[model samples]
Target: MASDQSTNPPIMEAKTRHPLHQIADTPTHKLLLKQWLKEEELILSRVSHKESQIDSVRREITQLYIFFFLFHSISLLLLFHASSSSSPSSASASSACKRSWIPSLCALLSSLGIIWAVRYKSEVESHLEKLLEREKEDAKLLRKCVEELKKKGIEFDLLKEVDALRRAKSLRVESKPVRKWSARDFVTLFFFSVSCLVLAMIRLILCD
Candidate 1:
């Protein structure tokens, strides 16, 4: 019974030390752990970088929206001012319109400028909104990938995941080209100019 008790102690000690010995003795486990730590660091860095990019994109979108609002306000004010000045009622206004073609021509140009500005603002707003949506989607995908990597015993290859993320990042949407003046624009401008000239002539004739 004494010998059995002594032998049992050694066996229990060996059993307790076995796992530690195995871990210390193996180079492969240490190497794998080092590699895994490196990968984790790299992934964390990438996620941080993506987060910064998303923040920058968000700021840009906000600026664009502000600018759009400003432009819209300016266009409305210009339109209101043009409408008020172009009225043929007041004798002074008619005399001003007749004295030189300048005031009437200025009103016509201002109206046309407002129309062009409004159209440009609308196009720019739409483009910025689309860009914001894409940035949000990218941020979501990156967060999801990070969560998956943090899971216990997850066997996903980190390199492959990072490569996939890079590929996705590369597939960016191209910006739409800015609209150029078309035949429609020319025609509209021509009509506006002619109408202003005719109105000025009519006012002058009435005043005389």
Candidate 2:
């Protein structure tokens, strides 16, 4: 066994790299690279267009939510004030009990609107997630095309720049409106929901 040992180092396996033969800067491959670059541009454009449509939908929902929140708050305040004003007049106690349904009914309607807004917000979030998933798939395809071109020895900095742009854009969020609405609206809805429950209970007590 000692006699069979060799002094030479073990042979290392070489990684088989593509562009195996140094490719010449031919017009055909440069055209191919250009085609891939064009495809990348198309991918970016599609994502931007879809995101804009989602943003439009989110804005419309926010506007409608604000409108209803203000309307209900105002109407609720007016009803409470009217109820309090007439409570001191002794002869009208039965009448006040009879009209207890008015504010209770208004509160019920406002609660329904709030529930609808919450449902719509959840829908917008789902749509945004779907858009992001589609964007990721498109980016994956573009990466494959770029890598293939690179393997053919047709190299350009354009794909690198495009990837950098895509990553940078991904780091940003277009969800400011969604986040702002959720934070503020959820708090408002919680308070309004409690107030509505309490008011309904009070109205029941008066009627009974």
Model 1, span 1-208: residue lDDT tens: 9999989987777556643353344564334445545655665566566556656655664564455446444644554455456766687666654554554455456556645654454455455556556656666666666555444112436567768877887886666679888644664565456446544643454344
Candidate 1: segments with Cα more than 4 A from true spot: 1-100, 152-154, 172-208
Cα lDDT listed for each candidate: 0.56, 0.64
lDDT of 2 at 100: 76
Query: Model 1 compared with the native: what TM-score?
Result: 0.40
Residue clash pairs of candidate 2: none
Question: Whole-model lDDT, candidate 2?
Answer: 0.64
Against the true structure, whose TM-score is highest? 2
Query: Candidate 1, 198: how far from true, in Å?
Result: 11
Return the TM-score for each candidate structure.
Answer: 0.40, 0.55
Candidate 2 regions with alpha-carbon error over 4 angstroms: 1-32, 57-65, 154-192, 195-208
